[model samples]
Target: MQKTCLAFAVVALLQPALNLWASDASLAVFEKRILPILQASKPSSCTECHLSGVELKDYIFPEQDKTFAALVKADMIDLKQPEQSKLLKFIERRPEKPSLITDKVRVEEAAAFREWIVAAVKDPQLLKAKSTASVGPQVSDELIRHARKDRVLNSFAENVWSEVGRCAACHSPDKNQAQVKKFGNRVSWIKPRDMQGTMQNLLDSGIIDVDAPEKSLLLAKPLMQVEHGGGQKMLLGDRTYKQFRAFIDDYVAVVKGTYKDAKALPKLSQEVSQVSEIWLKIEGIPKSLDKQFLRADVYAKTADGWSKERVATGDRAIFGGGGLWQQHLTLTAPRDSARAKELLSAQKLAGGEYLVRISIDRNNRLAQDPNSDFTKEDVIGEVPVRTNWPSGYGAMTVVKLPAQTR
Candidate 1:
């Protein structure tokens, strides 16, 4: 009984020393492996998931004890099972197709954190350490999520990728082989059907000026504010230009971390649209309306009367001398609606009778204010037409202006 009592006393006396030794070892691991991550000039593994606003170093500190304590206080470290630490889980999260270099960095970062966390949790001193210092990003969770790569990509797809068709003839790798031979591969800014690759190419080619978004070559070149080999592909206040600016401006804001809350983030449009090959022509346009912007909204004839929403829309400056206005149509639908899903797979206007509402910008409002949109007051007339909306410039559906206006 005395021998057993003495054995218990020895362990009780050595407990504090053992904890101190274990704590020192854990601190060594943090200083050697983890501190390098904090001090490195390059971004850590967090870049794999976050474009900005968050980094692995945000959870670390110069002082090991402070970092351990803060992480503990924030519930980032799981004492019962250190391997299941939230910080480790966060570090492990990766995109579907991560860059090889970043993936390597991610592996190293996860291993370093796992080693330190496993050892530190076993040290009673680290478990008992207390700290008031914050251990993660200073921004709100909403901002962090907004800065995620997936979210950024989705925004790119909606605002910029959807408009690439306007530039694809000269910019896409699949179609710009001749341009590449003359202008070098630099002109092939777009990857074939790869949104992420296209975005990266834009960034790498200095087309997207995050620092001065308005001055970006991507916007300036298309607007003809800068010399462009493709001539003027987009007007200053046209739908294509608006969509590009919306994406570039928002991308700059996101990277700069200017938004304080979710409300500050830019709102997405309720409607979705896609450029299509379907064309429309209106004859007998007045010479006075020449060079004036004309917009046409096509509504499918439904059992009730017409679709509550326009099925397709097209806009362009009228040709006064030709006494007609012609442009390709853009399929439209409310986002997330059944129509939107259908348009996603196929951009075809079904064969049927339709009502075409025409609006004329007499005051040049769109040019004066790019943000201005057509309203009921802008409607000049409505013409009824019946035809299968075929695809191609050669198969354009033709209609005449209302007799009153003609």
Candidate 2:
């Protein structure tokens, strides 16, 4: 009878489909087969790491290249003889004898994976496979389809040229205009060409950081009162500053191939009919998205007054705005996990009127920070959004909420 019972217990422990068993039944097997091998115990409760009590649902395993799920899908573990399973190989290799676990007593644990698996398979409280906590962030199917190299560039281009960040200004389209004009409409009055010379000049002078957007002087030129042709200081205001930042973002994106090419640019902005969730779309950029550099900031407001968050800060400047870049921010109740359960407790927010301020040092690296020379109290009209990026490159976006949701 004893040999028969031991065989039955081992069979149950090794079975693939059985993840949990009754606590009492699991304890019965643990007392007989696994108790003598333990070396030391852990401070963590026995059930925390064991299958009989808490199971593995609450625990998060380390990011493994080949996760247990893939292993199960590959049919590597045998359910009938769990002690002889490959999964048990890992547990048994622990530095303890007889018992597979290293922890000592007072913290009675699942000594071997065989013991744990047997308990898990029989436990009625074990979570279903779908409920495992090891899942990664969820991405939409549409976004996945658009992730092709060409489609990513297209989306980037569309986002750039919209009313948010108008690139056609300095980059003109044969619009007849006057020769040399004032600071406000210079791009509108001029033509577009390779800025390599301009950038090189700044780089040689140690103004811009080499190949880094956060330290580039080209990003800081437009927002200042620097000597253009005359000795006079010319100023680019808040609105112009933002548009210029958006332009650099596009320039970097296109150069990097985050935008597919000039041809795919227009199709990048095709508007969608519906928005079910927060949708982030990029298109028309070429392949080299990470090589270029740029910076942008996004801010939001709540009833408590003001709060801000940095949206993107990296070497790749793939995202651009149409001047009207729409960011759908969902503000949930503070740390209220129960808000999802209580319908009335959930706080819903639509778009609200906010401010977006951007500043750029177009000299590729000439102007020092506006705050350094000017008084800190005197809000320098150029880049009022107080976030730092590489020298010469900086951007800020202030969005206002719509009066009412549709």
TM-score of 1: 0.94
Candidate 2 lDDT, 1-406, residue by residue in tens:
9999999999887764443336455555544544333322432232212212121212223322122333334343354554565545433333212233324432233344456555544544332332233422133334323333244333322222222112233324344243224434333322334233333333355443434543343334332333233221112222223333434454344334344434443222112111112322223323332222222223344476444432221111223332122222222222223432332232232354323322223222213332122122322122223222211112223322122210
Q: What is the lDDT of residue 108 in candidate 1?
A: 93
Local accuracy of candidate 1 as per-residue lDDT tens digits, 1-406:
9999999999999998988899998999999999999999998878777777898889999998899999999999998999999999999988788889999999999999999999998888777788989988888888888988889888888788877877889998889889999999899998987889999889888899988888999989987899999986666577777888888888888878788888998887998988888999999998988888888999999899988999999888898999999988989999989889887569898998999999988888888898888889999899999999999989999999998866
Off by over 4 Å in 1: 1-10
Worst 10 residues of 1 by lDDT: 232-241
Please state every model's RMSD to the true fold in angstroms: 2.0, 21.9
Best by TM-score: 1
